[model samples]
Target: MGQPSQKPPSQKPPLQPWGRLLRFGGEESEPPVLLRRRELTIGRRRGCDLSFPGNKLISGDHCKIIVDEKSGQVSLEDTSTNGTVINKLKVVKKQTCPLQTGDVIYFVFRKNEPEHNVAYLYESLSEEHGLAQDSFEANKENMFHVTKDTSGAGQGDEPQFLPPLPTTQVCFEEPQPSTSTSDLFPRVATSSMEPPAGRAPPSSPDGEPNPNLHLLVTDQGGDTLSAPEGVRAVVEKPDRMEEQLTCCICQDLLYDCVSLQPCMHTFCAACYSGWMERSSLCPTCRCLVERICKNHILNNLVEAYLLQHPDKRRSEEDVQSMAARNKITQDMLQPKVRRSFSDEEDSLEDLLDLSDEDSESSDVSQPYIVCRQCPEYRRQVGQLFHYSGPGSEQRAMQAPGDTPSTSASVTPAQDYVCTLQGSHVICTCCFQPMPDRRAEREQDSRIAPQQCTVCLQPFCHLYWGCTRTGCLGCLAPFCELNLGDRCLDGVLNNNNYESDILKNYLATRGLTWKNVLADSLAALQRGVFLLTDYTVTGSTVLCYCCGLRSFRELTYQYRQNIPASELPVAVTSRPDCYWGRNCRTQVKAHHAMKFNHICEQTRFKN
Candidate 1:
């Protein structure tokens, strides 16, 4: 079996004529697999050129290493469940990736542990590089333990691994005429790399190999046209790009494409937005969608493809339906700043300034109107007031004797009309209709409606000049409010573990809510500021008591800033808590009395 037979030179070119795989890892001593043809399949299949019979991960027909004879370009097309990896990059199943020199191939690269799974180092071979048949025959017996003679030439009963000639002298054998005996082994009988029985090889209409056949799908009987050199540039056919461009959700051409993050799977923006209404996971990968962003690059490619095939363009009705379904936007990925109540006031002033500038300046008698969104029942242009300064005569306007909130102002009119009339949202507080401007100002915190941290529901708290009845404050109270007890009562009252921590801390002190309030008031009177005095902004979604405990823990930070002379004598003399604010023992009554909790940690031993 190891003896080299006196065979004539092959007439047809080899599948891959420029590269050979050097065995490594599991079989470092084995002979190199010679790539001698334009395409060589490697797997467990006996008919495969490079068969791995023992490896379970390697599929029957795992993958093919294809080489372009004229261009000398090498590529690996993956076709296995375990998949193939070249140069650390996993080749997508059924997709091709160009191979490069020094690329390492892995059959199954385990993430956690290294295994003896077969690995190969790709070496690009030149015309000068050749392995003599004698050197390869030395290791033939061990390498052909599983490989058998599929050709059935009746030369020997013992199986032998018949590899193609070395890269430097590679050749493809022409297909022999069919015979009755050869028909018995339909797949393995022929050594020639020809198309399967009855299936003609894919080629251009001019009887030449299609240069862009890889881009044009052949499984669906795609038409192959050969354009004359100057007639048209050979771009990928639109049909070939259909599968890549089509939206997985809608099963149509992608319109306003968007990509889900983490997974990086793409779909139509409207399709995904609608899908998110029911589930936040990606439709393709089932992974949680952390963020969504416009796939501008894919959108551009889709647009180019649609330009070539206008029929693939979605109709106006379908486009509108998609637009209506779209809820998520690129703004969701934007960095959101937790806005304070003052930020809204600044935006309101800016809007007022703009409105004043737009009014006619010629007539001094004509009063300049500010809020057009407000109803006629509300304050008129002449009645509007501006808050200049303490010295200025202007003062905040007083509500009408009837209280405008009680009037029809809170209710939407039967014939109300505006640019965004259909998109108006009723304010939860005022019960008044306010135009939803989130779509227009989503990227800007100053203009967008502030959302509650706990509920994540957008509230009509900003000054839109249309209504002033809503809670015009940072309803998503922060640590500052929690520390000062300014947060609305009962809003976040809940029985939870975080709340229990606070309850235990207070109970151990034998102090009621009134006692704590009085102490905080006394501290304010003595000019002993808490953490909120230095930092006025921050948001939280924690339950009421938990928020208080978080603020209480932060109180030590402000106390540390005070000079010993400025600090209270009790706190100045009290020993600092070993774990400081992060003290797990703070919840224990004995530890709370032993050490001062209003100071930074003295030891970081833990």
Candidate 2:
């Protein structure tokens, strides 16, 4: 009995088709055709759903729009080399971004060449509602259908249905006679005349005819109405006080009116203040007003007028407040003095002198060695490597050596210090100090031992390979970790390999590195460095023979001449520089061997 009355199966709802109405030209231009497909492919290729052939800006498969029938959601995926921007924000390549109604999309050809780019306005539509379809079809007659010519030039031909031009006709109407007395005296009574019910007879106070009413209305005889004998009708000039009250600059009823001195021309306080920045002259007559002041009488008049027309007061106040905020921001952004090397040196020297005096005054005299690695030296117990010496002056004067003396009471140096002594090994990749052989050997047994050819310093290699690979062109040793899979041999074998590698590397860090590399390359080409023969490798700028160096070393080598302040600091910070002029001779020999050049002309001059 219960199974006898089973309900009929419920019917599923129809899937609503979603589409986009892509507008190409300006907003005032004719509407675009409504694309009703589930997926719309847009590109310059002939196979694309919407193709723009011969347009270098559009890639073969520029982008696609996908409409989800179930969710009624629309998304756009960019697939072009130039990139697609939505609402001024760049859409991620190969990633779908949700699109809303009235979203603006731009196909950027070249970032700097925005003029050549194309823009489109996106409008989402649903098949459930026929309004969008009807409107699109209505305007379809006016829209152009583009077709490629057999000769290969892409251009749109005129539509099939052309509307006929409308003809213009001329007609003239006969003049009509005037009926009202106010029409007879048009100029006098046009603005001030009252309604017929409000109109009253001219009042004769003290048995005297009103002169004002005589001027307003006149009979067919051209005489004043009910006037005293010999009293002629004189039209008093229309009150032009409102015209005088308007600001010359803003051309509106003045707010906080201020008058220029000598010229006495009135303007809105905010407008005049903004104008004074460019010119101190009156905008109307161009008269100089160096000593400008607010006209309080005119300001009162303007305030009275503003009270009657209360709409403009808020806007004027807002303008003044915005200007004040802008001024404050400008003041905040004023350029500040940057610290220079001389200032840093002076401060550092003062600090060192103070520390020396403190050590002389203290009961327990501690021996400190002036670090030859870094510029600034502050006397802290464990901050510097100190050794027992006869005096502080002698300790500072002692020759810079790598050997750790037995008499030396070694202390850990600052992180930036690179004296190349004790357990400090400079990393071949970053040119920064890493754990030395002792530290690496103590920490992990699996750590493979390696040495940098440039610095001749031993280090542990965990990633990539243990031994450094020499550049095939320059014969310079470079760490595999830093150089990635790139090598000079690969670059020489294939010309595009280096460019492809650089492009991939630049993509990882974003495109900003290209400009940095360009600037460094320019500097190198200009012979800014003592060692001119160098090349840009990824983010690092390396000397052709000596490999990578710290930024400080590069700066020192670029200058060629040492500054007095930097003399106390390490003169020979890099291993090549530490080896003296002989290092250049050896580098030339290696360059000659790798490049197959004669060493006679290429020998180190200095």
Instruction: Specify the highest-lDDT model's number.
Output: 1
430-487, model 2: which lDDT tens digit per residue? 3334434444545864443345334444432331112234422121222222322332
Query: Model 1, which residues run further than 4 Å from truth?
Result: 1-262, 265-283, 286-511, 535-579, 582-599, 603-606
Task: Give the per-residue lDDT of model 1 (tens digit) for 235-254.
Answer: 22223466577565544567
| Model 2 poorest 10 in a row by lDDT | 158-167
lDDT of each: 0.46, 0.40
